[model samples]
Target: MGNSEATLRVDNVTKRFGDFTAVEGLSFDVRAGRVFGFLGPNGAGKTTTIRMIVGITAPDEGKIELFGERMSPKMQDRIGYLPEERGLYKKMKIVDQLRYFAALKDVPQSVADKRIDKWLERMNLAEWKNKKTTDLSKGMQQKIQFISTVLHDPDLLILDEPFSGLDPVNVEFMIDVMSEFKSQDKTIIFSTHLMETAERLCNDILLINKSKKVISGSLREVKASYGKNLIALRAVGGEAMLGDRSLVAKATEHSDEIEIELAENADPQALLKKLIESGANISKFEKVEPSLNDIFIDQIGGVK
Candidate 1:
């Protein structure tokens, strides 16, 4: 959490590809030093919105502002963008490629050199600095791309699926880096469909479906709005009772357990008593709030 001032604002923005509307009336704001989640499934126009924010394309309607002013060339360097797609010169050495990318942001040569090496060493890529990007693994290249994105130490970072191709370890490393940025009063706009990851990192989130804003708010507010109508149940031989619509609204299976949402006016005690009467071995049952995934299911009518 940080100041209430907005670092970026997308006001009533819309984009269309001819007759096909990609994004419509999308509006959200990222507060200073907060991780704002831009969440949606594939083809949800997340990329389109990102492109518009970064000035790769203009919104067909509405406007975007950064630091109280419209996006301009002079304001570009103040923000870092790590696009979902990989863009790197395969034949160029790691150090050279990073330096070149840094130069694009107008970072001085001396500063670029120090930042490049620091990032390389921090990510355990220093030994491979002389090697071409083609020689590194996909995971390594992704880290390099992230390094290049932050080399200029921009005030705002728009990371579009930054952890998409990374393994769990690398993903944590990226999360740590983003956390560090936040601690320094830098804001981040993280775009991803992984609700669990967003749950862990985001202070606020905007969930979209079919290019439309479905919900947007602080993570706590959104979850609290959905209420604590869920129960995480782990029981043997209770599967048959779960199908009773009078008690359960929905049940999505997770590994070795079931997340059950109670139907309107349904009693939690009744459901538990039914499981006990069924001679089931009940090990775990706890009332829990709806997860972001559960909320997404309600909004989008199913997983994408």
Candidate 2:
């Protein structure tokens, strides 16, 4: 993320509906040219926050500024948004639908047509361009909706659960596509509960709980703050390979080995030596770092 380009700022934003407050004092900045992860469990106000940013729902209090200007109707054309729910008309042909959305954004026909074709090719949807959106499979339809969001070449993108139902292969495809968007210096704010994806893709992340930011920072910084070192050990021996569980702090058993969360004072070298001497036939014993899921559980607790 470049500090030079303007940022999208949400200053002390809050939203309410009658008796319920959907988002409260929510604030963050999506810096230009980076993928920012907006993460939380279900009903954590991620959607509400995104809705305000895209101007679909106004905040009850506070402000949203994009490119140093307050968000306004005209700024609609400057952003590309893919909501969590799919909304494209099933009857429209892909090309026609793309052109219609482009026109809605005030894109001229000649340029719209050319850009449509380019995006179709870039997404490998060129052959499906003439087919009706209804004719494609669920995953394929997802691909089309994704194209519709980016067709206008907007500077900022807001994606909600972009990989929800995608298979492993399609998920990989989406990651590759997102990587391309970042290369162009386009800002992307992705909302998802999938920790692994956020762990791999985001340059910065904001984790919310009960409509408040519980954690926000670079991935390295966040994980390092967890204060426990992860270690994975694999050996040929049975449970005895682990020795007395007392020697380790907390251990989780994998199919073939055990993963331990070493206490701060526990010496990893001593543990390794103990395991080797116990006739454990150690194949691998490596210290692992905490995953996003661990940190999430540590901060947000379990689902309600």
Candidate 3:
């Protein structure tokens, strides 16, 4: 899949509303069959960017290409978009809503019905198929929304905050669905504030801040690029040892561990030696990899 053409490409895209720029000079390529995470803080232009991708709005500058062609109405049926906001006709029956959505995408009623049955059953909403959408719990409603999104089996799925309002079990079910999509070679652009979820599902990520791209790369390379600057230490009295100006820049203490950020030029071995010398019962000392959450905060300049 390394040589597969990008499923979607945003080239030098920018969006301006009046005097404010929502997205500025953005560029990235999402490869086929890989789960891509689109992330940014609120008002950082993630929603605007998504709108442009879905053809809800046009970019003020540059261009977006999908399926190796310029983005257009004809290309939209190949993409399934689930917006961050929930919108359902509360008066509509659950199954009727699915049929209507499928019809909008040009799916025949018979085919839509079969696909709806399959998805509703898969989502454990088979029993609620005849119920009004307003009658279901928030979690059940979310499942219904999910069913509507995939009713036509679009090649690329854009999920914005897909796991919101789901219980733990439902969250797992959603994750499994995303993984299943991957197995079917369906590409996804997943957006969520759940850093751990993004880390688990996204093969690549594009992070934006202040309407600009901060970083974009494979997940492994992104984490590796941050380097092993964090240390996880478990020693009975070694918290005090983290105060050495030359070795430790900052330390966040947990009940049974200390997460130490190494000062520039500090050696992990030197920090361990100091902990031993301080008479602490050293149990563990190791270089820690920065997580997606860590990188997100660091890149956005939100870290203290």
Candidate 4:
């Protein structure tokens, strides 16, 4: 049985393409009015799982439920999906394309026109309304695609790699738009390889690797599970001390500071004493909480 509050549920779902397993025993719930992130590295079954959730493809085993019921065509009117692959008609005008998609969702022509105009203006695409979609820049087209997804005002929105091909400014714009949707009590599920974005945007996340789940929980719980084993140091002359394996199991150097993974059972106090004795000028040295990126690298065996 699905949780009454869950907008979508995947129960031990698995998908196989010939002999290769695309997803394995995956189970998670997207609760209503929450921003849920589906995170994974490339080929980590993110897209495959998304396809199954939207009913574009069926899972070989297990069950999927939307709105406390088995997934079916009736749910199509309630879902707005933006695939990773861009699919706008190149030659079609932006307004017409959006209108066509809205109509497909059973929105009336009059209503679609009003919503299209409002969305176009909000997305800063008002001037390009009559222009061919192919003529817009990639970022502009991305905004148009996003507008199309929400034009029908569906209860749930599933976006795959929505930030791809967008500049930083446009990415922020999309983030703001998502925040607005959440404030309006809409449910959202988005898949991304960008851990930073996911960390900032999602209320809950499921991190997968090589077709299997590595972690799934609220962001705070997942990060807290790793404990404070990471040390962030910003120093003028103590970077060389990071090479001492007695203190650090692994060290990653940045332009301004270095992050070190402490050796097992190594006391942080003792490590700080050693760095001081090494004639280093340390500006910042503290046991900092691990970031989602750090946790991901640790769990996945490396950075994506």
Candidate 5:
């Protein structure tokens, strides 16, 4: 048997379309009871990889195992997948649509009914239960789709861009629900380009670029590997400091602060001294860790 603690494993997987390679020699393990982030920019093979994971498409090479077994049709009921595309029945009542989806997963009416009512109330959709899905706002529709995905109480939940249309409030709501799922030991794979959300929510992350794995590990480990050479500085009249190539390699100015990337072998103390000598009023200057967004830029050659 495969490692019992592993919820999902992708081993040397590769997928191609015609002459283009979508995912190349990818390998990773998602442990049980953790939120795993699958991160990449647009057209970075994120969706294609997700498709292979849920068995919507077969890998051109290598293997994928879920719950220590090869992915098969029988496992569908145990997996809740929220695709990037929205596919709710436009005319169906929200509650009825949820019931229909739960039934497809082999959940009996008695259980589905109870779960549907509970989830709708929990998601604040109880008041809109009888409304047609097409009549709900984008955020509301997204929540309904999310409810349909998890109402069956699946063991593994795969969410692709789950926060795509959500407002800040709904985004937090989704995060809270995912946390609840983790507390229940339900494994989740969250795929998105929003590094900020992934940075905050995921226990482990796999960052891909150009169809290849760029980094993979616990968020702490991955950030630590990048080293702390970045400095966040907030000061007045430091525009000239940005051009000092000896003290700074690259500087990106923000509305209220500047992100300074130190050149290799440059000393932070010397940079600070130079700023002081330049008569710049420094408010915030600290050796801070790089955010996932910064790491993504560095890894992918500054591609947005």
Candidate 6:
């Protein structure tokens, strides 16, 4: 919501198959050049929603707009989509697969070849370019799939669980690549169950549970709205302060320290004074704001 230029808009979209409702009254806007985070648990209609946006399936109600126009083939060509299910031909050569996808996206063969070569070298897949996808490791295949996704250099990219199967190192590499794409003014939307990735990668987020939006906004705004002001203290004598229920809501203990959530009306300065007076050695006394993971659990976990 920081910028108002809508690159993609879903207005009260609802989708159904027979008697089952996949997405009901879902609405949100993805601004241009921003990394939008889509969050939901398993079977929460995240994929279905992505499909609707990409024009794989039309909504039974409502509408979708892309670049100020209704969804169309023109808009489709400008989109890069990586579905949740990995779909590369295991027997196909990496270079051939990239060429095929690039063709499908309307890139000329000559242009596709140069782009493929450059991306393979940049992504460390140069040696594997001619190898069959089956012979490559899962991580290698993932890198190829990513190359295919961006081979056409689409304006809008929709990634479903883009980080599903990767180690910490590759995940960090993917994060870096995503930022690079954003720097080039591409609009990226990705769905993830990993809150830490979203925390570091996304500029804005939409948290949905059971096909309903529970939270949406910038990270700072969402954390501030949680209205939680907490502080952690480490001390040999602060056990007495923990006994005073008026200053703290809950105290969770560790081997050598404790984290306490403070009541809203309790003055932070007053609590620090009391801790000092109780002869407690303050090791850490920083505000404990709610993280995206905490908010995700509270909102999605609270669903009926």
What does candidate 4's lDDT look like per residue over 1-304, in tens digits? 2223888889999999999999999999888778998887888999899888888899999999998899887788889899998778999998899989998889999999999989888888899999998799988988998988988898889999999999998899899989988887788998887888988999988999998888998888888787758888887766667777887899888898888889988888987888888888889997887788888888888634
User: Can you list the residue pairs that collide in candidate 5?
Assistant: none
The ten-residue window of minimal lDDT in model 6 covers 227-236
RMSD of each: 4.8, 3.8, 3.7, 4.8, 4.7, 2.7
Q: After superposition, how far is residue 173 of candidate 4 from its true place, in Å?
A: 1.1
Each model's lDDT comes to 0.91, 0.84, 0.89, 0.87, 0.89, 0.86
lDDT over C-alpha atoms for residue 2 of model 4: 25
User: Which predicted model would earn the best lDDT?
Assistant: 1
Off by over 4 Å in 1: 231-285, 302-304
Candidate 3's residue-wise lDDT over 37-56, tens digit each? 99888888999999999899
lDDT of 1 at 128: 92
Give the candidate number with the greatest TM-score: 6
Full-model lDDT, candidate 5? 0.89
For each candidate in turn, the TM-score is 0.82, 0.82, 0.85, 0.81, 0.81, 0.89
Task: Write candidate 1's Cα lDDT for 187-209 as tens digits.
Answer: 99998878899999999999988
Worst 10 residues of 1 by lDDT: 295-304
Query: Looking at candidate 6, what is the lDDT of residue 204?
Result: 83
Tens digits of per-residue lDDT for model 5 on 1-304?
2323889899999999999999999999998889999998888899888888888899999999989899787788899999999688999998789889999999999999999889889988789999997789988889889989998898899999999988998899899999999988889999988889999999999999889998999999999888758899999875787788887999988888888999888999999998888899999998888899999889888544
True-structure lDDT of candidate 1: 0.91
Worst ten in a row by lDDT for model 3: 295-304
Off by over 4 Å in 4: 1-4, 230-285, 302-304
